[model samples]
Target: MAPTTDPATTDLDRVIGFTIPGRHARGRVARLGPVLHAILSAHAYPPVIERLLAESLTLTALLGTTLKNAEGQMTLQAQTEKGIVSLMVCDYKDGELRGYVKFDAERLARLGKNPSLHALFNKGYLAITFDQVTTKERYQGIVPLDGETIAQAAESYFLQSEQIPSVVRLGVRRDAQGMLIAGGIFLQHLPEGEVGRERLHVRLDHPEWQHVEAMGATMGADELADPALPLETLVWRLFNEEPEVRLLGGTSLARGCRCDATYIQQVLTKFPETERAEMADENGVISVDCAFCSTKFPIALADFVPDAL
Candidate 1:
């Protein structure tokens, strides 16, 4: 059944974790509101692009909270030979999140109003990278962009690369006044053995897993994306039939970017002297703008001067 939203409900922007006790199954639900608006409003992205970015952001929140440490982060990246959407990167660090997309504006404009994922990113490859502070080595998996949406592509990555039975449902739409809203849910069947196995073991035949997946399919976009619907009710609406459904916890997300003048300074110092000189305008001032958040940082040529004292 679809969850209804009340007229007076506030924007819902949080991620919640849950588990099916004894069944060894886990899931996450993400609802976006003002955070999504903040991210998408930074640029003049078309409606389709806005929706795509929203899905990526929702997926990041769902996947990021799965980390064990407070400082861990995960990044999802996609690259394609087609000029439509050349590159896209979405990252979630700790509770912070940010992302950006690179595409051929002319080509994108030619595609018209609504373009399929395949049309937008033909022959693209999706890659997921994990950066945990405690681990000496970072982990990453690469897969082809085979599905109609980003959610489906992620599901393929889990089953094919991680050998886990996973499900992801994402919904994004604009309101009557053209406000972007997005939400998503994710589920994965845990192995009977202990967590964090050295090698992944496929477990698609579990009866409980099948049942959970079936119930999850019944969730509609109206229920998942509507800010009016409380997240607690959504979880119960989907899994109330289970014998031992339990809530792990929940965390709110915001549109966060790590870019700052200090970081941009470091980036500029790395450039060769000639390159630095070339970056300057007629007035010899260097300007840097963050593609993700569109925050501009203007630096004087003297700042790059070596030992001016």
Candidate 2:
């Protein structure tokens, strides 16, 4: 979809950015329909895990889309040494998004109905990473994943890691058609310039941030997840009274995974001959499956792996 400047218009699977000029705050609103269905349906994960992944995807979009023009990727990963869910990853590159979750089925089954994040990922830590492709700069922040949901974890990340006063809210639901729809809103009081940032640092607990966050906190999950509600309307409803609410429309997002047969084959060639042989079947074909997209790639061993190694 082409970029739109109108705040009243809406589209499926797009992230819209907005700013409250007087408050010195900026935010991104994400409303995803087809994108969420495409991602969750590919895996058909259990309901419990699906919800967790949904939250992860929404949170990823809320933060990832902020990487405006930079050709880079934002990745969120949660891991634990001992837990039902050992690992979960949600990545966004450009406007593409993908997610992966690994858990012990037996352990997950023990949870009755609703499993809290702490119960599912005991001692887990959430890691948010930003990798700028053009600059080759990578920055990561790790915070304990003790919150009830990924949204809460994100709030903790901004506070402890980014040191930015921010508020994040995410919602996911299965529509009547059984397609997963997710939405998220994020608000941060960004400093105008270096001088302004220095002043902001000196007084990190500014009242303007508190006010913006309070207004954002008033937004409920139902309103956010409503398929009929446009993102621009949500912003308007929340901050119309502010001096200025600047909204920019048109960053389309889709289900995305970085998987290439040739690239996979290249990586396999470096493996030892014995290891490569073990990966092959009777037909000498190595079947590699991508956890992100659930696509299986059968590469002919002779196509890339030499006899020597």
Candidate 3:
């Protein structure tokens, strides 16, 4: 089917944060347009991989926006024993994100179209890492890839590790012209006593939480992927019955990369002289490609020489 071209979604690339103040529920809605296309178009990825990458990017955006104290970067990574798709990583810091997939193209091709998540990444484990730039401290969680989708894996992460009741849904589809569009929404029930301030815990027995989960499940692909459906409209449609729900606000997102000549040079300097020499081409220039943005940078060997050396 041709993708819907709702004017509301057109050119929209932002994450909207919302809250059910009375019910102690908070969530985020993210819709990506040009930003998503630009990232996927950089490489000739298969339709399956395209969809998977879109889901990862959307999930990263959702997680990044909801974080309160994160200063550096958060990464979601998965590796499988099947070798069809060995690794997938999505990195989010601030409001910017970049991700890439490492897969066995030949093996993936043989699996046929629309393979199951397990078929793509059999016996895999999913890991989430938080790198705090200011404190130079790292925290991470690893979970077995038990669900049918990445969203399910993420939901499990919150429930099993963080003890937070969370729900996440991600959608990615191609329009008639083959341009990709994606959207994601996340809902988590706040802890008791205080909404956002209480200790992390799960209370699935809460009546309101059940109602919210049911409403969120009704979200259709068109509703999420359609550019014409404004973020407010989506929230309203999902929880109109709950008048206390509040639309907090939103923030913009874009395709961004931190890789540059300076950063690349610093990395190469750590390599021994023999390794650096081996990396250079005939012109004595080292070439490195940023897998996230697919940007290529070339640096002269002299640039890596330390002044004190």
TM-scores for all candidates: the values are 0.91, 0.91, 0.89
Q: Give per-residue lDDT, candidate 1, residue 275.
A: 82
Which pairs clash (backbone N, Cα, C closer than 3 Å) in model 2?
none
**Worst ten-residue run, lDDT, model 1?**
1-10
lDDT of 3 at 286: 89
Which segments of candidate 3 are over 4 A away from where they belong? 1-11, 135-137, 194-204, 306-309
Ranking of all candidate structures by their lDDT, best first: 2, 1, 3
lDDT of 1 by residue, 117-145 (tens): 89999998889988888875688999888
lDDT of each: 0.83, 0.83, 0.82
Report the C-alpha lDDT of model 2 over 1-309, residue by residue, as the tens digit.
222223244346888898888888999888777777778777758999988888788889888987755488999999998999999999999899999899999988888779888999999899999988888888899988867888888888888887777788988776665766678899988877765346554674778878998999998888788777878889989988887888866588888888989889889988888898899999999999999999999998788635652
Q: In model 1, which regions exceed 4 Å deviation? A: 1-8, 194-204, 305-309
lDDT of 3: 0.82
Better of 2 and 3 by TM-score: 2
C-alpha RMSD between model 1 and the true structure = 4.0
Tell me the tens digit of each residue's lDDT in model 3 across 1-309.
Answer: 233455453646789999997667888899887777778877789999998989889998888776555477888899986758899988888778788998999988898778877888998998988887888888898988878888888899888777787889888876666668889899998766665654444332677777778788888777787776788888988888786877777878878778888898888888888888899999999899988878889988887664355
When sorted by TM-score, best at the front, the candidate numbers are 2, 1, 3
Candidate 2: C-alpha lDDT:
0.83
